[model samples]
Target: MSVDKRKTIFDKLLGSDIKAELLIFFHRNPSFSGSLNDLASKINKPIEEVEKAVEDFVKLGLLNEVKHYYFDPEADKELQNLVLEDLTKEESKSTFELIKDVEKTNIEVLDKLLPDGFPPSGLILILSDPAAGKDILSIQILCTKIAVGRKGLFITLDKFPDEIRDFMLEFGFNSSVFEKENKLVFIDCYSPQVGIKSKEKYSEDPLNFPNLSILISRVLKELNSPIVVFDSLSTLLQKGGVRSSLEFLRSLTGKIKESKALCFVTLNRRAFHPAILAASEEIVDGVIEMKVEETEGKVENYIRVFKMMRRRHSSSWLPYIIDVEKGLLPKT
Candidate 1:
């Protein structure tokens, strides 16, 4: 007779096919705690193997042994009740409250880029090639919101908060005033990478999607009608794999929609996989594509609206100039 060796879901979780099967059996028959000989017979395994697996589970804190019977201590009533409470709790807001009027939310540079103003509550993707002014444009858009008395949250994955602050100051926008007034907040996702402790709401591990989601949620809950800027999505795509990055974006967008806040996420067009880029574009409300052109001896920057959902937008690419004194200015 040949023994079966098919992998099960528990096998993946426990890293041992036989142990996973035993765990499943125990879970199914929660009250059936038995001796090693009985468990070995029930699972059709050697008594020694059964004993080893049981001892492993006990060491891992998944099971407990009392008077020669192994059982799952996590199946206790108090823990079960806590899990049920989490599963049954109602969300703070409904779907209808998430969607907002796109016409009323006005972003300064965005208004000039799109025929209509910024959307009220959705993700906006900004794509550009390297050195194409994507970061500068995104910062200018954020500063525009801050200048208009709207709260802004900048999640910087590629640059330190001080670097971003210096850039803003060099471009003639004083970020200190906004920081002092508590209108601008920065979630520093880069400082920890270089052995430096972050002073802001720091994410020690940027690749941890659940941690990042929780941090963003807590911040958004405290603010009202804010503009959230993800400095660059490409960094996240590199840190986390494609699937995890996509899942993170989906969850973040859902939260942004729920809060009725505008989200601006930038991506380096050339750094991402084609499939990942397509997947990201599908989730956003609008897309702004930017590029640089060498004309004669000078480099010129241009931008255009690639797509805007539920709004009339210009598809024509227009030339733009970055002025240190005035920020981004549309060339006449």
Candidate 2:
């Protein structure tokens, strides 16, 4: 917009990416390695571009060379700057910058366009058809959090501990990662023993979310990560009707709003009513729809941020897919 900006390539570049597109993408996927091949396949970017881009990235100290693999690039710098160096007031500008950035964002996730960070702290809904890889999506998000040593709270209305463990093992996530990292945690809201409601009023406390709120709140207070997800809203509302579902979700959203976590709720379109969906619309920050359809004469999977109550929405569905060994990869 300015003559001076047009004259300078760096100046034009500074504000050109006025928004945080690349940062948000990596934030959504922190655990992923960014090897030349991996980054090319995962981002649908050209291999040569990835190599050139990452070479500049490493030279800038924005990324680290790890076992010949490139980190999220914005890898945690805070922990790395642990050694304290005495400083005086009004030192060199570089020294000032280094001292101030003691809490380095070593996360390979956030070092995108900005040297700062983009924190995802809001509500999200992931809706898909039954058996359409909803659980896999949840696992991907969970693994992303764990990769950065951040904790995850999975409030499941569907799967049990053993069931989830088995699922992750299929994707090469070892049980030690869960236990040692203490990253992945599950709140079994699906159990009737915790107030799921049976003939005798579901385990003594009838209106309780079957310990759903309790576990979620605890995780919120403890987790250092920005990501949190609910397995499936369908099961939470399974015993209740549409009105009850509306009330429960409304209350749940209110509770989630009080926390400092970015949240997501999974749903099946057929399992929910259109009227209830409309009623619960106010509490949602955004709705992301996942679908598999024939595109370019092939079956493709996509994740699109359809609506964002707080910000402008992405008009297109970003396509993504998973391979047998590589796991979830963003297609477009």
Candidate 3:
């Protein structure tokens, strides 16, 4: 007789089939709480069998029992938000309406990138090498959106809110004024790593993916037609494995697309695994590849609109210069 080995590890760890099923049930229904009898009836098992499973879970600290009811003690608001409806579609504007709105925004930088402006709603993946000015480019884009009277939410895992503000100020963009006017918000994901408490609108432990999602969802829900910028996915990938990081991005992007908001996520090409980069490219609406080239020790930075779904854009790499007064300038 052939023995099944697939569940061997799980069975040994859970000790019984009923316990494994109970664990699986709680995992699938994280927000559920029920009395022992109710759980047994739901699982279609006898009361005694369910009781044994519940005892095993409680002893292993996987579940908590109080007054004959069992629940996952570790399940919190963050976990609940993580599993929230990611595909809830919002009524997006028509392509024509979106173009009109973009024109009304009057962002010059975007005018240079796409004479027509960004797509109505979609994700843009910004790829670049380290210190190649990816963050600066993202900030410039966000500042332009804000300048055009659009609200923005910047979730920065690479730099603290203060540092970002300082950089923007140096680039001649007054982001602090926007913060004071409530036109812009920053979710500081870097402060916790340095043991610094954040005074920004939203702050979260960068390594806690669930909390990060919850914070993002809260901001997206409150804002209207907001431009969201995630200041580097490579940092997230390092903190969370490729699977969890990609899953988080997929869920977050789904929410962004449904809300019809523009989102830009920076990814360090050298930092990400090739497979991860390829998978991410498939999920976004466009890919902006930034590169720095050195010819005879003179360096030049260029950007290419490698892909933009449902739109016509320049496929050739365009040279760009960083001017202290102008931010990112596309050289003609």
Candidate 4:
């Protein structure tokens, strides 16, 4: 039986430097066959340890062992390319001079909006009017982060996990692959309150602020530099009241910052009072606002950076349109 390549590679390939060296050697010398002792001496590792690792790889169909072990050229070919590509990228990075410490969200418009890209541990709030596509934009940002080899935690307050997954698939993002690799997680706060049993591993009542915070903290601890997206904060404000929601935001942002992660929270600008919106904005590191206007029976969407702490951004509302394949795009 062939072992799951994605699972094995994600879990074990980076388990140790020894495993990496072994895999690299096998990939580079696909046709090479050697005994356990020979392979151990080649990589300068102990025969006992190498033999165990080699057997594990053989079981995973990465290697074929008849008289001696050799790389299985046809085994998980796609994953093999991904592994090699990732390893090559690491090697290339080692040769280059580091430019900035911030992680790129991989969104083109952001390059113009945030000149420095997204700073680690920054909490960004997305405020939009009804049907302005804030939820779609947030998910796109999350998917973008995941595409760039970062993990993401999406806390769904207004939608089902399945709906989110379907949306991801519609945009050509494979949510299943991300979930299987443990790179994308969904906290189904919507399901429990809707009286539908959640299929997610992490879930809590949306109204239970304390339990929700604990659940989020536990998941955040397991991820590294993850991108977190709160579908919409309006649900929190409605369910927990303005004061409790503000307190939760402060606590959650602090936890996210401590983890050195990035979080994007969504909110409906018209859902609460102006004073409440001002208070909410105070808790965030930056704010991006979106709105739609109908003129002469034609409707258009626009987005702008309302406030970005310590960063220069274009406050001018730029026109935008949603594409079926691309979640959101700057109007050309």
Candidate 5:
């Protein structure tokens, strides 16, 4: 019959090249009616191979074969345009260059109590209680960068992008800004535990970084963004163990120093091992430690900028609150 034109066409078009290229060939030589031999000689493919391919294309209704074969320009119009599309190739490098270039700028967003430009390209840590606002504050830091047209990567070990989005909205950010602009990207670490996609994603390419470090490294190298956030280091060490995870983090901090990106890392104070914490302390540019003290029924929390190496941080903890409208409000 009519070859069920739609089904056969889509199936064969899986390996099809641009229709525009075929059209150009026809334009070059208006004498287009050809057996596979004539078309292959013109197009520089082996006639035998072209014969089989043409047969498949004809079955798909993308070609017509009467005395000779001719392409049906309408059969796979949209797919043909995509096959002919050269856009993805040309703009890839510049996008990557822009992402890598963000590290050299001098502008920094620091605490109000501390000086304005804190830890410009340095590594920083957010240490806090399990349920504290460190993760929320980190998201605010990212949204702030995104508002300025800068980009950030969230390599989350504990939260999903949707949950992070919900958390952002809870902190007063409209999630659409992230969805529309794509200034924020998520690398789902999901867990240090061996469930679901973690182990496979971590080990998929054996040639890459060992365990979590490799995952983080490939991301930093590939991303040209100005900021990166590792949601929680404690989880990795707890799950992947001291030597593998900690060594990877140590190497990661070193690798990150070569770029201009601001690396904001998160760590859990209670569960974090001494070696991991020590590695972070020695390598990162600053540490923002969050702790809670209980007075009767109320529990109070504070953030101390314990150390900011290159940038001068004040003597004590910088106060910050999670404001409904403003997200993370730095106390003066």
Candidate 6:
């Protein structure tokens, strides 16, 4: 006689066999998106029965209720792995765990703060002044990730695509190479705002929050866990106002988390109300702050991690310099 330890664990965690079965089904088919009827047909169960089971899982935090039911990306990892281990017993190891590995942010200084890289669907918020090197840091992150064969989606709220590409060239990142590979995409919100039709395939008015959300959702669906950047989210706040901008950010962050994408959003510290800034900071997984100060006629750049949830980080301010060719460099 043998005891099924895995089954015991699953039963204790889920408390029901149908819930355990659904967990395995969703793990094996992460891309499954259909109605209850469709899922019921595939699972060989009654529609009513399947709907009740799925509703139960959703209420229990195991499933997400979108247009269709799917496994929640933010679900408990240890419990998820335990359920998946039983389902994938034929394999030598679970591919689910491999796919869940953290994606590294390749910036040298920032990598030191985020030693474990980014957790799945990590949301980072950047607060800095115009001259504080925030944009340069973002470009460096995008370029490094793209160089490593990861896809990137740049939401340009403050610059044209050509201007951004030129800026990247100044920092020694050849954006054209990644653009040619179709692994890099730009949403030219800036051009549309200035009454100029953007030549880029994706362009939307910054004030049109719904359309911007739709465009981002479409782009994210085409790429697998790409790095998404909102260069100067302050433009959105300036144009849309605090209430509308916060609503838009809530929707945007929800989409990013559900897609398991790494997102970096930049906000100018001098632009919006402090209350809005505080609210924005509350919505993200981490916040990195930068400042520029002049002392004795020499301007210096400083950065620090203000807050990072569930990660160990040094909050001490670090001196750094923006190199014309190499982007951001730690001051010696």
lDDT of 3 by residue, 121-211 (tens): 7889998877667887788888878887889989988888888888888877888788888889899988887898888768998678888
Estimate the overall C-alpha local distance difference test score of candidate 4: 0.77
Instruction: Identify the superior model by lDDT, candidate 1 or candidate 2.
Output: 1
Task: Give all candidates' CA lDDT scores.
Answer: 0.70, 0.52, 0.70, 0.77, 0.58, 0.74
Output the worst ten-in-a-row residue range by lDDT, candidate 6. 90-99
Model 4 segments beyond 4 Å from truth?
1-104
Could you tell me the TM-score of candidate 3? 0.67
Q: Which is the winner by TM-score between candidate 2 and candidate 5?
A: 5
Candidate 2 lDDT score at position 7: 26
Q: What digit string (tens of lDDT, one per residue) describes model 4 on residues 1-332?
A: 12264335544443444555576566557677888878999988988878777766776777788888777667747554565455334333333224356555577666667665665667999999999888789988988878978899999999999999998898889899989989999999999878998888988997788888888888998987799999778888766655667789999889888888899999988665343555567578778989999999999999988766655566678888978788778888
Candidate 6 deviant stretches above 4 angstroms:
1-104
Count of clashes in candidate 5: 5
The TM-scores of all predictions, comma-separated, are: 0.66, 0.55, 0.67, 0.68, 0.58, 0.68
lDDT by residue (1-332, candidate 6, tens digit) is: 01375434433434443444455467567677777777888767778767777876676566678787766555645454544344323222212223345555677778767665655577789999779989889988888888888899999988899999999888778888888888999999998778998899899998888888998999998887898889877877655655567678888888988888989999987664332455577567778889898999999999887766555456678889988888888788
| Reference-based lDDT, residue 204, model 5 | 28
* TM-score top scorer: 4
By lDDT, is 3 or 6 better? Answer: 6
* TM-score, prediction 2: 0.55
Candidate 2 ranges with C-alpha deviation above 4 Å: 1-119, 193-207, 224-226, 294-298, 309-313
Per-residue lDDT tens digits for candidate 5, residues 183-298, read: 56666666433245542223222112365565666766666635888877776654554445545666767767876678888888756423234445645666777776678997
Clash pairs, model 4 backbone: none
Count of backbone clashes for each model? 0, 12, 0, 0, 5, 0
